[model samples]
Structures are given as C-alpha cells and as structure tokens.
Target chain A: MSDEIVELTASQAAAAVHAGELDPGELFETYRARAAADTLNAYLWVSDRTPAGPPAGEPAATSSPLGGVPLAVKDLFCTEGVPSQAGSRILEGYRPPYSATVVRRLAQAGAPLLGKTNQDEFAMGSSNENSGFGPVRNPWDETRVPGGSSGGSAAAVAAGLAPWAIGTDTGGSVRQPAALCGIVGLKPTYGACSRFGMIAFASSLDQAGPLTRDVTDAALLLRHMVGRDPRDSTSLEFPEPIELPTREDLRGIRLGVPDELVGEGGGVQDGVRRSFEQTLELARGLGATVEPCRLPHAPHALSAYYLIAPAEASANLARFDGVRYGLRVDSGADLVSMYSRTRAAGFGPEVKRRIMLGTYALSSGYYDAYYGTALRVRTKIAEDFRTAFQSFDFVVTPTSPWTAFELGAKLEDPLAMYLNDFCTVPMPLAGIPAISIPSGLSEGLPVGFQLAGPAFSENRLLAAAYALERAIGFDSSPARRRDPGGSTP
Target chain B: MLERAQVDHVARLARLELSDAEAERMAVELSKVLDHIEKIRELDLEGVPPTSHVVDVVNALRADEPTSSLPREVALRSAPEPVAGGFGVPSPGAGGE
Candidate 1:
C-alpha cells in the first residue's frame, strides 16, 4: 500500500483525494517518511505538521485545486516559521516572520509544505556541492551530481520523496538538474511569479520554477504560483491563465534548432548529440517543421551571464551585514571588522569568489571593460532571440552538453562548472520561457530536450512540450534504481 | 590576470576577509573567469545599448499607504543580537584601524 501510494503523481493523488480514495493526512505522512529517510541529502528540513484534513464537509478539490497534495520547496523560499536557509550558513536557522508569496499561495491552494530541500549556497554554484550543508547526491547513481543549485528539489521529485518541488533558475539551476535527474523543469517568463520573499541571488535573472515528474504536473503547479504582488515591483500579472496542455500533435509548430548550441565545437558529448538528433527526428514525424537556426551571440551568453549575475549578487548580498538577521562573527573590536568577519565566516568559497569578482568588475576603472561590456553583450543576445522568434515559434537545444558527471569532477574548476549553463543561460538573458523535458537516455543517463519561446509564451511552450513528451516517451523510473546500501551517504 | 594584492583589495571593497591561502587561490581563479569574459570586449557593440533590465518597467512605485508591518519582536527574532528592540552592533570606534 505504501509503495503504491508513493508511485502516484501529484495529479493522480489529488484526484484520489477528491474521490475520497486517499486521505490527505496519509498522503502527507508517506512523503514525509520518504523525505526523512532520503539518502541523497535532498531535504534540509522536513515538516512535521500533519495537514488538517480539508475542512469538515467540503470536497477536497473544491477546497483547493491542489487537493491537499504535499510540496517540497527549495530552501530559498522563506516559509514563515520554517527555516529558510537558502542553503547557506550565513542565514542558518533564520526563519522568516513571513512566507514568500509563492509559498503562501501554494499553501492556500491546498498544497501542504512537506520539506525544505538543499541547494548550492545562495544559488551560486552549478552543482549542489557548494551547499553549506552536505551535497545532495544523484538518486539515479549515488556517485554523481543531480545538477544544481536546484539539485535537492530535482532529486526529491525524481526519487518520489515529494510529488513535486519548486526550484529557482538564475541560469540553468532548474533545467540542468531536471535533465540530469530525468524529470520535467520549467523556467517561467521573467516576473511571471512574484519574487517577494525569495532570498535574492541575482535579482534580474532569478525566477522560481517547478521540477516535476511530468509536463502536466509542471503546468499544474505553475498555474497557482504566478501573480503580481504588491511587494515585488518587478512582478507582473500573467497575461493569460495557465492551462494543462491537452494538445497531442504538433501539426503547425515550427521548432528552430540553434547551431550555436547544438553544432560541433559546442562541447556536447556524442551520446547527448545522438539523443538530441533522434528527438528532432521524432518531432519531424509528429508533423512539426524543424529547421536549423542561428543564435550567433548565444555562444557568448555564459561569459555575459557570469559577469552580470555576480554583479547583481554583489549588491544584493550586501544586506547580510552583522547588524541585521542571520549569522554574525564579531571581532569584538569595531563595526568594520565585525561586518568583514561575519561575512567571511558565513559565506562559502564560491560566494566569496563571486563577490570579489563582481566588486572588481564594478570597480572604477574596469567597469566599462567588464560590467558595461557584459550588459551590451546581453543586448546582442536578446536581439538574436528576437530575430529567431520572427521565423520560428520555438527554439530548441540540448539542455546541457553532457549528463551528470561524478560528484567532485568539476568542483575544482569553476570555469568547467560555469560551462554547464552554456545552453540554458541565453533564455534567462532574453527573459524568455524555456522548458526541459527528458528526451531520452544516453550512456544510461537522462538527456534533456529544451524548448524555448518568446516572452510570455509559456502556454504555447507547455503545449508543444506535452506533444513531444508523448512522442519521445522517455521512461523516468530508472531514477528509483537505488541500491539498498546507497541509503547511507 | 589579477594579482594577490588586487584580490585582497577587492575583498576589502566587498566587505569580506580572505585568508592568505584563499587570496592566492582567488587571484588565479578570478583571472581565469575574467579571461573567458574578455571575449565580449572584442564584439562591436558601438550602437547597442546596455540592457540593465530585460523588461521595460519604470518607476514601479506602490501607492503611499500605511499598512500593518512586522512587529519589532518578530522582526528582530532572527537578529544575532537584539538590543533595545533593535539589532545590536559593535560600537563604531571601539577598535580603530
């Protein structure tokens, strides 16, 4: 019974609850127990509250669209009384007095908080290894990463610890991990979801997205997550209501395969390339026209993103002075030393590296050469997308050049780690929407097929992905192939 | 490439203190990142305007109205040292440079 319960997706579980076939309390307990028993170090904190079964006489579905389904949130979302650490020691044990807008809305819509998942410190690294807490292991093979800074959230969904989870994508944080973990991930158009209580990383780029076992679940979760909030000035009301895609054929869709991302010299592994080519063939068979397109400036997106994101981070992170909330290391002398000591003690190597890099880039003489040039490069990248959208309804690429590598493989080289975002960074730079769905397996690992569309085109993107997902039919069950002894990291 | 002294200077500007070992390593690592970023300077962006924000939103100020705010105690709950209904800090001149 427990095994069967764990196998149901959030949609199926919600339906069962509406029909009185599954008790909400029992459903929450099953996921909570699995989360507490997680060997991947996915969950930083698990909630103990057994949800009060939907008010006395109301049907579960009528009370909330989620039907009391439980959710796993990345630690970056402030959850009122729950510890929202953002996977950093600086904010350790610092529970916010209020919940993030997204978290609050999801809870109001009947999804109970299941746990807070681990991530890279301040959402800075490409792998979960940078987390102040221990790294989150890949459930598919315990030896490799699950991709990050959304590693824990992706691992939780792929391993069935949570029905679904929310993760933030500054660059490829959501999609890269989803690809590696064999699940669906989506980065909504910029400002689609309010950023109210989410701990700031790179303000201009960070957007909260969902990591789910399937495309439909991704759509369902996103419907309730987006809205304008009074607190977040950048947030805008979604142009249209999100709908679960019912489209099964791509009869009129035009998919642009960008040479900059998929062509030779892009460092894409042979196995990944082969899988991507096969998926393109599948798209053609479904009556979709696939043409080679060029996003010329996309090749330089990583260079621009690394500078821009960190520059914003350097300013946003300045709020962590010793005088305010979070950890403080006092020098017992003066205020300046106190601030310096607290930050040095609290931040990890990656965070400090970025802060220093950003400060240098923005400093007097180098600003024009580094920071200013990066922003101009950003303009060209966005222009490339604009030109492509004139001809193609959607642009496609392999989410990452390679599948998940060993745990410590890229840890020593930050450049190699930054390269992981090569394919996914351009969309965020353009402020467009992109979704990564499992295309197939290569070398016994999952490869993601990414579909990106112009700004506010999520409905169209989701529909196209749903059709392709059915045609590709990649199995995600291998994520549960955990060894009995693998439970102890 | 950034020098060790340069890294230390940047760290001070960012309000972070790095150990000698960290500074040495940072000088090399930050240089590698900056080298990759150097490619952008080669592009002719003479007419291209910098995009600080992707979406065009200007002066997005909310209406001036007072609403309930976080109580002082609740706001200070996460502070490392709460003093006199506020966050406590070291005296400004207790220890001089």
Candidate 2:
C-alpha cells in the first residue's frame, strides 16, 4: 500500500485521502522515508516534524481539495522557521518569521509541507550548480542537470520524493527544469501568484509556479496557489476564482507554431526536434489545427531577458547588503568596506557576474543604450505575441533547444548557459502563461513541448496541455525512478 | 570587450569588491554578454515604446487600516548581527579607510 501510494500523483493521493482510503500520516511517512533515502539531493531542508492531521471536530481529509497531500516547496518561498535560502550563501541560515502568501494558502488548503527544495543561487542559474549547498542531480541520469533554478523541485517530483512541488519561473526556471526532468511545469501569468515572501529574482519576470508529475496535478496546485493579496501590489484580482476547464478534447483549439522557434536556424537539437514534430502530430490527432505563426521579435528575447532580468535583479538584491539581514562580513574599516566585503563573500560567481552586468547596463550613460534598448525590444516581443494571439488560441515550442546537458558542461561558458533559456524566455518577457509537458524521450532522456497562451488564459493553456498530455501519453514515472538508498546509476 | 577599468568602475557603483582576478575575468565575460544582447540594437524602434512591466499596474491602495505586524524580535530573528531590537550594523565611519 505504501509503495502504491508513493507512486500516486498528487491528485490521486488527494482523492485517496478524501475517500478515506489512504492515511495522510502514512502518506507523509512514505514521502519522508523516500526523502531520507533521496540520492538526488533534491531537498535543501526537510522538516522532521510530521503533519498535524485534522483538527478536533473535523473528519480526516475533509479540509480542502488538496487536503492531506504532501508537497515540497522550492527554497525561494519563505516558510516560517524553515530555511529559505534561495540557494545562495548570503542567505544561509536565514529563516523567515512568517510564511509567504502562497505557502500560507497551501497550508490553509491542507497540503502538508515535506521540505524546502534546492535551487540556483538567488534563482539565477540555469543549472542547480549555483546552489550554495550543492547541485541537484537529474534522476534520469546522474551526470545530467535537472534543469534549474527549480531543478530540485523538478527532480523531487521525478524521483518520487514528493507527489508535487512548487517552483518559480523567471526565464523558464520552472518550465525548463520540468522539461528536462520529464514532468509537467506550469508557469502562471504574471501577477497570478502573489510574490510577497518569495525571494525576489527579477521583480518583473519572477512568478511562482508549480512543477508536478502531470497536468491534472498542475491544475489542482495552481487553483490553491493563486489569489489576490494586498501585500503584493502586483497581484491580480479575479472577480471570481479562475475555473480550470475540464475539457480534454482539443477540438476547435488552434495552436500556433512559432516559425522562428521551430525554423531551420532555431538551434533545436535533432532529438528534441524529432520529439517536437511528433508532438505536433499528436496534437493534430487530438483535433487541434497547428498553424505557422511568426514572432519576429522573439529572436531578441534572449538578449532582452539578459539585460532586463539582471537590471531588475541588481536593484532587488541591493537590500542584501550586510546591513539588514542574512550573512554579514565586517571589515571594521568603514560601512562601504563592510558592504563590499560582505557582498563579495556572500554572492556566488554566477550571481556576481550578473550583478556586474546589470550594474553596467543600468549605470550612468549606458542605461539608455543597454536597459533602455532591452525594454523597447521587450515591448516589441510582447506586441509580437499580442499579434499572434489574435489568430491563435495558443502557441507551441520545444521547451528547450535540447535535453538536459551534462552538469559541468556549460558552467564555464556563461553565454552558452544563458542560451538554455532561448526557447522559454519569450513567454515571461510577454507575461503570458505557459506549461512544459513531456513530449517524449530522446536518447533515453525526456524532451518537453511548451504550450503558451495570452495573459489570463491559463484555463485554455492548461486545457490544451491536458489534451496533448493525454494524446502524447507521457509516462511520468520513468524506469529510472531509483530507490533512495541505492547509488545513482 | 569591456576594459578592466570599466569593470572596476561598475563594481564600485554596484558596491561589490571584486578581486583583481575577478575583475579581469568579468571584463571578458561581461563583454560577451553585452555583445550577445547587442542583438536588441538591430531592431528599428522609431515609434516603439519601452515596457517596464508586462501587466498594466496602478496603485493598489488598500483601506487605511492598521493590522498586527511581525514583532520586532521576529523581524530581527534572521539578522546575523542583532542589537537592541534591530539588526546591528557598524557605524558609518567604522569602515572608513
């Protein structure tokens, strides 16, 4: 029973708990055991404390739709008394006194916390190698990366350490890792999930999302995670709760295939290209018409993102100066020296590289040329999406140019590392919702096909993904799902 | 490529104390990033406006209401150096060379 329960998706576990067929405490213990034996290093901090279970008068599992399901949170989201380091040394040993808005809501909905997962330092790196603790290995092949900054969250779900986990997407942090790890990752529209306690990466592009085993689980998690919050002035208010469309059929759904993303010079890998083309066929069989669309400005998205994200990150991360909280290095020479010394020691190489780039971009005379140009290109990218959406309900792309690369392969080359986000960055730049669902395997690894839609079109976006999910018939549980105590193959 | 002097200037503005080696390395790497993003300059932006945010945001002012806030102790809980009910920091002149 424990073995079967461990294999169940979040939705399945929730249903079993709701029906009184599975014990929530037992389920929690099962995940706890799996986490204890985890070889992937997916969790940064695992809570030893067990679930509180139902209150005095209420019956078990009657709490909420997600009641009794165990889930892991990305370390970026603040959990009271739990380490929320955002995978950087600067924030090591730091724990928020209060839970983030999303964390609070998940607890209210009765999803018990298993632990906080690993991530890129300050959610900045493409690979989890930038983590202050260590890199999270891909469960599929240990030598490969699990995609990142949410690599641990994706790896956790892939490794069955947790039923589902939460992640954040800024330039495909959530979706890219989800794709590489062979799970479903949904990045909700900008302002959909309140960012109150989630550590800031790029204020404009950062949005909390879910990395789950399947589309159904992604929708269930999103329903509970999103709502308006007065704390986040950017939070979008819905007059009514966003209802997820349950329609599985894709009849009459029009999916736009971006010509630039799929064209000959798009830099897509051979294996990923084959799987993506097969996915398009699968979509066609599901009664959706795939049309060629042009995002002429998308070629500039990677360029724009590098500037815009770092520019915003430089400002948001400025508060980390040794004065307020977290790690502080004191030189005793002066405040300036203390700040410089603290920051120099606190931030990792990738983080410093970005901060330097951002500082240069936003500095005196260069601001108008670098950041200014990037912002204008960003508008053009959004306009390109706006024009594309007028004719198509959704746009599709190969989630990344290729499958997960080796762990240390791109670490030394910053530009090559940044290119990993080439295919996924445009959606965040446009502030649209997108999901990466496993299309199929390539060279014994998984490839993800991304489905994106206009802002507030999550229901449609998810519906299309669901239809494709059913059509493609992806097995979330691969044969590589290893025992926690065993050495990684 | 960015000059080492330019890297030094940016690091000072960003308040980071880069080592001699790090500044030299940053000069080469940041130059590559800047060159890659120079693709943005290829676009004709005669009438295009810059978008600071994707969503159209207005002030989301709330009712003038007071609510219980995190206690001072709680707020100061994560501070690496805490003093009397707040984060402890060196005085302004303490780090002066």
Candidate 3:
C-alpha cells in the first residue's frame, strides 16, 4: 500500500482524495515519514502535524482544487511560525510573523505544508554547495549535485519525498535544478506571481515557480500560485486562468533555436547537444516547424545578469543590520562596528562577495561603466527576444550546458558556476516565461529541453511542452533507476 | 584588477567587515568577474535607455484604509536582542576604531 501511494503523481493523489479513495491524513503521513528519513538532506524542516481541514465556512478538502496534496516549499517563502531561513545562517531560525501570500493561497486551496527544503544561501550559486545548511545530494548519483539554488526542492520531488514543491527563479535557480533532477520546472512571466513575503534575491527577476514530476502537474500547481497582491506592486493579474493542456501533437507550432545559446561558442556538452538536436527532430516529426533564430546579445546575458542582480541584492540585503531580526554580533563597539561585524559574521562567503561586487559596481565613479552599462545591455537582450518572437512561437535551447556534475566540481571557480546560467538567463531579463521539460537522458542523467515564449504566453508554452512531452516519452521515476528492490520507504 | 584596498573600500561601503585574507581573496575573484563584465563596454549603447524595471507599473499604491498590523510581541519574536519594547542595538558613540 505504501509503495503504491509513493508511485502516484500529485495529480493522481489529488484525484484519489477528491473521489474518497484516499484519506488526506494517511497521504500526509506517508510523505512525512519519508521526508523525516531523507538522507539527501532535501528537507530542512518537516511538519509534525497533519494539516487540519480548511477553516470554517471554506470548502472541505475533498472539494478543493488541490484536494489536500502536500507541498514541499523552498525555505525562502516566509511561513508564519515556521523557520524560513532562505538557507542562510544570517536568518537562521528566524520565522516570519505572517505567511507569504502564495502560502496562504495554497493553504486555502487545500494543499498542506509538507516541509521546508534547503537551498543555496539567499538563492545564490548554481550548485547546492553554497547552502549554509550543507548541499543536497542528487538522488540519481549521490556524489553529484542536484543543481541549485532550488536544489532541495527539485531533489525532493525527484526522490518522491514530496509530490510537488515551490521554488523561486532568479536566473535559472528553479529550472536548472529541475533539469538536473529530472522533473518539470516553470518560471512564469515577470509580475505573474506576487513577490510579497518571498525573501528578495534580485527584486526585478525573482519569481516563484513549481517543480513537479510532469508538465500537467506544473501547470496545475501554477494555476493557484499566480495573482496580484496589493503588497507586491509589481504583481499583475494573470490575463486568464490556466487550463490543463491536452494537446498531444504540435501541428502548426514554430520553434526558434537561438544560435548564440546553442552554437559552438556556448560550451554545450556533446551529450546535451545531441539530446537537444534529437528533441528538435522529434518536434519536427510531431508536425512542428523547427528553425534557427538569432538572439545576438544573448551571448552576453551572464555578464549583464551578474551585475544587475548583485547590484539590487546589495541594496536589498542592507536590511539585515542586526537591529530588527535574525542573527546579531555585538562587537562591543559603536553602531557602525556592530553593523559591520553582524553582517560579516552572518552572511556566507558568496553573499559577501556579491555584496562587495555590487557595492563596487554602484560606487560613485564606477556606476556608469558597470551598473548603467549592464542595464543598457539588458535592454538590447530584451530587444533581441522581442525581435525573435516576431518570427517564432517559442525559443528553444538546452536548459543546462551539461548534466549534473560532481558536488565540488565548480565550487572553486565562481565563473564556471555562473556559466551554468548562460542559456537560462536571457528569458528572465526579457521578463518572459520559460519551462524546462525532461527531453531524455544524457549519459544516464536527465537533460532538459527548455521552451520559452513572450510575456504572458504560459498557456501556449505549456500546451506546446505538453505535446512534446508525450512525443518524447521520457521516464521521470528516479527510484527505478537507483534501486530495483524499491526499498526507499 | 581590483586591489586589496579597493576591496576593503567596497566592503566598508557595504557595511561588511572582512578579514585580511577574505579581502585578499575577494580582490582576485572580483577582478575576474569585472573582467568578464567589461565585455559589455564594446557594444554601442548610445541611444539605449537603461531598464530599471521590466514591467511598467506606475504608482502602485493601495487604499488608504487601515488594516491590522503585526503585534509588537510577534514582530519582535525574531530579534536577536529585544529591548523593553523594541530591538536593541549598540550606542552610536560607543567604542570603535
């Protein structure tokens, strides 16, 4: 019975619960036990209590859209009374007084809290190694990283510790991890999801998304995760409700393969490139038109993103000055010394490096040369995408340059780590939506094929991805590949 | 390339106190990053305007009506050092270099 329960996808579990075939409490316990024993370090904190039914006057769990499926949340989303640390020592043990608007909405829709997952500190770094709590291991290969800063969330879903999880993407944090872990991850258009109560990383680029086993689940989870909130002025109403995609063939669809991202200069690995080409061929077979398109400025996206994101981060993180919350180091000196000491002690090395880089970029003399230029480059990148969309319905690329590398492979080289976002950064800069779907394995590890569209085009992207997914027939179960006995539970 | 002194100056501007070793390491790492970012200077951005925000939202103010706020005790729950009724901090004129 436990084995059968673990095999069900989130959509299946929700359906079973709604039809009175599965008890919501029983469903919660099964996942809770697995999360408590998680050896991947995927979860930072697991809830002990089974969620109560919706509050009085609300619909029962069986009638709700989510139907009581449990969710694993990345630690950045502030859950009232639950430790929401954003995987940094600076905010360790600090629980927000109120939950994020997204968390409250999911609860109202009948999804219960499964646990808080680990991540890279303040959602920085490509691999999970930057997490202050320690890195999460890839379930496929324990020696390899799951990719990050949403590594824990992706790992949780892939390892079946949780049916689905939420992660924030600021330069491919969500999609890259999901691609490495063999699952679906979506980054909605900018302003599609509210940013309130989500610990800010890069204000303009941060957007929360879902990591799940399939495209259908990703679409379902995102349906309830979007909307406008007065607290987040940047958030706007989604033009329409998301519907489950049923398209199984991509007839009349046009895909644009960005030359700058996929060409030889991008450092794409042999296996990943092969898989991407094969997926394009498969799309062509499914009646879609595949053509090469150019985003000329995309080659420089990584440099622009690094400058812009860190510049915003330097300003946003200034609030952690030991006066209001979290960790504090009293230097037994003046307020200035105290502030400096607290921050230096609290933030990890990567966070400190970014803060220094940002400060230098925004400094009096250097501002025009660095931050100002990066912003202008950003406009050109957006223009590139806008021009490409005029000729194609979706932009296609390999989600990552390669499959998951060993945990410590790139830690010594920050440049190498930043390169992991090379193919995934342009869409976010353009404020467009993109989704990463598992195309197939590259050397026995998953390689994701990414499809991105113009702003507010999630419905069409998901439909196209759904069609490609059925045609590819990629197997998503990690347990089957790891152990024949299926003894994880 | 960023010198150690420049790294220290930026650290001070950011209100972070780094040891000599971390500062030295940062100088090298930050220099490499800046070298890569310098590629943007080759582009002709004469007429390009800087994008501060991707979405065009003007004056996103909400209603002036009052709503219940976090209670004093709940708000202070995570403070490292809570004073009689607020957060505690070192005095402005206390000891320092």
iRMS of each prediction: 1.6, 1.9, 1.8
Worst 10 residues of 3 chain A by lDDT: A480-489
Model 2 lDDT per residue over A1-489, tens place: 767987888888898888888888888888988887777889988878676775344445654678678889999899888888899899988888888999888777878789999999999988899888999999888889999999999999998898999999999999999999999999999999999999999999999998998888998899988888999988987434655547767899888999888787579999999999999888888888999999998988999999999999899989998766788898665788778889999999999998998988999999989999999999999999999999999999999998999989999999999989988999999999999999999998999999999998887787788878888888866633576777654
Model 1, span A1-489: residue lDDT tens = 767887788888888888889988888998888888888899999988676665344445435789898999999999988999999999999889999999988887888789999999999987799999989988877789999999999999998889999999999999999999999999999999999999999999999999999999999999999988999999988989999998998997999999888888579999899999999999999889999998999989999999999999999999998777898898576888888999999999999989988899899899988999989999999999999999999999999999989999999999999999999999999999999999999878889999999999999999999999999998877675453235522
lDDT of model 1 at residue A193? 94
Please tell me the TM-score of chain A for candidate 2.
0.97
Candidate 3, which segments miss by more than 4 Å at Cα? A480-489, B94-97
TM-score of each: 0.97, 0.97, 0.98
Per-residue error (Å), model 1, residue A162: 0.5
**Clashing residue pair totals per candidate (backbone < 3 A):** 0, 4, 0
Candidate 1 vs candidate 2, DockQ winner: 1
Worst 10 residues of 1 chain B by lDDT: B88-97
Clashing pairs in 1: none
Candidate lDDT scores, in order, read 0.90, 0.88, 0.90
For candidate 3, lDDT tens digit of each residue in A1-489? 766887898989999999999988899888898888788888999999887777556688789899888999999999988999999999999889998888888888878889999999999988989998999988878789999999999999998889899999999999999999999999999999999999999998999999999999999899999999988999999999988889988898999998899998799999999999999999999999999999999999999999999999999999999889888898577899889998999999999989988889899999999999999999999999999999999999999998999989999888889999999999899899999999999888899999999999999999999999999999877542343223332
